[model samples]
Target: MTSPRPHERLLASMMRALPESGIVLFGADSVFPMIAIFAARRWGKNLTVVSAVNTIDPRPDFLPYSTMDPPAGHRGSYVIPMAEAYDLVGRGEVDHIFVSAAQIDAHGALNSSVIRMDDGPDKRLPGGGGLAMILRTVSVVDAWKPVHLRRTFPPRVDFVTGVGNLRHVITPMAIMTMEEEELRVSSIRSGDTLDKVQDATEFTLQLTTKESGLSRAIAEPTAEEIDCIERVDPRGVRYATEVY
Candidate 1:
């Protein structure tokens, strides 16, 4: 079999970093979180993946095209009402929360709602569904985006839907984390260089005087991980077409 793509490898690494077992919360449309749940299960890490409206312990055999729509014959352990989920978030009971960002600034604040282009309602983007509470109370918040562009990793986002509580920001080219309220490049894919990472981002990366080298090498996905991803995403919708 061929090797996993760069993005896949990055995502797999992110998934591996999750706690071995706990109550994890995944975004409705987040791809990596779902994949990570499947990975954790496959790796024998007992975890309950909580959706915004349901608790998926022992996730479905077939991955859903969207979190709101589960596959045929799939069942969740119990339904998590919106109110209950929000309460859990408010209580800070959720171990980890995974979210996808449209725009993330240096302060780790994210803008996933409202048209950031001009601030008006003309092009209203998808408003923050549960990010506000999730960011405020979730112990760990991981944000990711499929795209790697200058506009995506801006110095500052125009609008803030969720502020603070960002732990990691995984992208196609690198893995970024906040340091001293500023975004720092922590790791880079094998083919990606410091110059490329800097070109794609707007913030000044803190590379020197770090524990790891300038760019922490991102390892390739193992065969077992590839198999898990294949089984979880049978239609290959998440992996195919090089799209999220």
Candidate 2:
């Protein structure tokens, strides 16, 4: 009967946002793939998990911290080439995609390339692999970042790695959605406030009007949700990259 931890709550929130049934493509991030797998198994939602490693509908016994782990593809149904996976996305066969970014702008554009600093040399990051194409082609793209800070949610990203079809940007503090091509605070996470979210964000939040959807708050993880999360991630791999 212990309360769900911060990372567990975050995982439950992300899992609840997933579609009931569709092909969900998980990026290279560690946590998102775990959520997708949990959703697929717990709800029996007919959800198909397409891993970044090109494993189609993998049925791993336990959630792997890294989607590339061999256990992630253990007892899988089929293995498709990476090219074919992207081709499916381009053909609109993919339903949802989970991606991550080092920096996300108000326009929902993602930056995973490099961070330009004024006082120091440019800090290079791992470039977005297939993010540009997948984001544009996928019907729904949900992006997540473990840490929420002003630097992470900037007014504008230094470089645009991907921009299209970004529906929601989920963070530990809040969930921002695209409205009129701009990111707006859709729902503040449990135990978080609008002030805290605004203070952590770099852009001016459009939460003044009722239509801005600032009144909505993310629901806390239910007992069932927490149970599912624990069952899938008994080793707590969901906390592999979480910051809070």
C-alpha TM-score for every candidate: 0.89, 0.93
Q: Lowest-scoring 10 consecutive residues by lDDT in candidate 2?
A: 206-215
Winning model by TM-score:
2
The global C-alpha lDDT for each of the candidates, from Candidate 1 onward, is: 0.72, 0.79
Worst 10 residues of 1 by lDDT: 206-215
Question: 1-244 in candidate 2: lDDT tens per residue?
Answer: 6867778667766786788888887766556546645654585567887776778888778777777777877676889898888889888889887788899998889999999999999999999888898888888888887788899988899999888999888787888888888998888877788889999999989752335433478778788888787777788786666557
Residue runs of model 1 more than 4 Å from their true location after superposition: 118-122, 208-215, 240-244
Count of residue pairs whose backbone atoms collide, per candidate: 0, 0
| Candidate 2 lDDT (Cα, 0 to 1) | 0.79
* Model 2 TM-score (2 dp): 0.93
User: What are the per-residue Cα lDDT tens digits for candidate 1 across 27-51?
Assistant: 6676567776776677677777776
